[model samples]
Target: MGTDMGKKESLLFCLDRFLDPWFGYQLPYQDAIVDLLQVVIVSDNTLSVKEAALQLICDYAWPPFPVLEENFERVEAELRPDVSYAMHMDKEIETDS
Candidate 1:
């Protein structure tokens, strides 16, 4: 499990490097950008990292692709459990009272 986690982190690092150059520049190909983001999101081992990368794509990537938007929605859905747990902790505490 540790080895797998290490590999996932390494892959994410490489992807970050690949994305760095394109951050400020205009994307030349829509398909390539979408494909790259898909790879990043799918390769992510943790929900937090996947959510962060998806948010980055939504915030930074230009000429918004529908496929990317769809991917974001899907990732967001996957993240709902974490979000709900974090946001509803107070409600749980109140219920226990």
Candidate 2:
């Protein structure tokens, strides 16, 4: 995914390390970030990428947002973040007991 896999990983790690502590664990992946932003960041109570980013950062003040593609300006507040953009997905891993 445009060589930005690391950034996505960082985002997921942030959410997991911070959010999971308070909200419980989840699949740490790009799709998680995208899904979370859609549900938490894109709120009617506020608008704009900056606002969404601010709220998101506030929500999980552990691992910070990394500077990479920084692709928020392209989207309108009316639009939603979709998990469909996450790339290189594999079937759910079955861990050995």
Candidate 3:
């Protein structure tokens, strides 16, 4: 498990490097970007990383290719922007409880 985590971290680092230059630059490779993002989305990784990838996809592919939009919807459906919980807690506590 530790080895797997190390590998994932390494891959993420490499991806970060590869993507850093294209932060705000326009590119002609729409297909490549979409494909890479889809791989990241379905990869067994942390939510934050997945969200970042999704954001990048939206940034470059905003016109919405079918596959890109489908992946975007999947990530959106799994996110809970309004919810928060205490450390190690399963759910948020009610103030009036």
| TM-score winner | 3
Candidate 3, after superposition: displacement of residue 5 in Å?
Answer: 7.2
Give every collision pair in model 3: none
Name the 10 consecutive residues with the lowest summed lDDT in model 3.
82-91
Between candidates 1 and 3, name the one with more favorable TM-score: 3
Candidate 2 C-alpha lDDT tens digits along 1-97: 1235455445545654655446665556644554446443323323443344444444443332222114444434343232111110112122322
1-97, model 1: which lDDT tens digit per residue? 1336556556555555445665554447745755565555655457655655455454344433444435544545666454344334556667999
The CA lDDT of each predicted structure is: 0.51, 0.39, 0.49
Clashes of 1: 0
Give Cα distance to truth, residue 33, candidate 2, Å. 2.4
What TM-score quantifies how close candidate 2 is to the native fold?
A: 0.26
Q: State TM-scores per candidate.
A: 0.40, 0.26, 0.42
Cα displacement (angstroms), candidate 1, residue 65, comes to: 2.8
Better of 1 and 3 by lDDT: 1
RMSD (Å) of each candidate, 1 decimal:
10.5, 13.7, 11.0
RMSD of 2: 13.7
Task: Give, for candidate 1, the lowest lDDT window spanning 10 residues.
Answer: 59-68
lDDT of 3 by residue, 27-47 (tens): 567567667666666555677
